[model samples]
Target: MNNEVNGDGPDSCGIRILGETRDLTVVNNRIGNAPKGQQHIGILIGEKSDRIELRENELSGNLDRKIEDRREEKLWPVQIRR
Candidate 1:
């Protein structure tokens, strides 16, 4: 699935949960490789949310690399909530 996700929600992001939710879990899957020129995100949990359980998932190669970029990414693979 190129930029497509199978989550239990109406608006389909890779996985976007909101509000005073807690204890999220992402497990057992290989999420990688964006169709050239795309920022393939493996996952994202909101900052307000807490106690994320990430286990036994093969997540790799989700990045957007290009030349002439001004702001260098301080973090590799991905960046999470501030």
Candidate 2:
């Protein structure tokens, strides 16, 4: 919580939840907005991740989609899911 993230890469993101990550919570953060011409994403939930929560986050000015969940079976958020 209370973080501001920025990165530069083809797959760069403000926050990235990858691999077998589970039972996690992300809240009250500001994500994305890389320098001009940089590829930046706000939140990236990877394919194998699960049981994650994102709450009250502010995502803006990303080069791509604000939040990208690449899970084959998408889940909803009373909290959030990968």
Candidate 3:
């Protein structure tokens, strides 16, 4: 699937696909910023998903309140591969 978010305002996420039951592919997307008053993420991949690939995309400016969350642990201004 193709996911993209382009704006100055904060957004919850560019794409959030939870409980995906099949193989998935995410390519050429841009995710950034979190909502106001609440810390959110640019992209969130739940534990239920498997065989997922994130390629040729941009993720930045994620505001995560919870330091323990995985989204909070990232290398900003660059692509993170897992």
By lDDT, the better pick of 1 and 3 is 3
How would the candidate models be sorted by TM-score, starting from the highest? 2, 3, 1
- What are the per-residue Cα lDDT tens digits for candidate 2 across 1-82? 3334344666777778899888789988766574554646777889888777888887776457777788887664426422
Per-model lDDT? 0.43, 0.70, 0.47
Candidate 2's C-alpha runs over 4 A off are 1-7, 75-82
Ranking according to lDDT, highest score first: 2, 3, 1
Error of 2 at 41 (Å): 1.0
Report the alpha-carbon TM-score of model 3 versus the true structure: 0.52
User: Model 3, 1-82: lDDT tens per residue?
Assistant: 2334434343344565566323667787655554443325556555455555667766655445211123322222223353
Best TM-score goes to which candidate? 2
Worst 10-residue lDDT window for candidate 1 reads: 65-74
Pairs with backbone N, CA or C atoms under 3 Å apart (clashes), candidate 1? none
Clash totals for all candidate models: 0, 0, 0
* Model 2 alpha-carbon miss at residue 4, Å: 8.0
Q: How close is candidate 2 to the true structure, as a TM-score?
A: 0.73
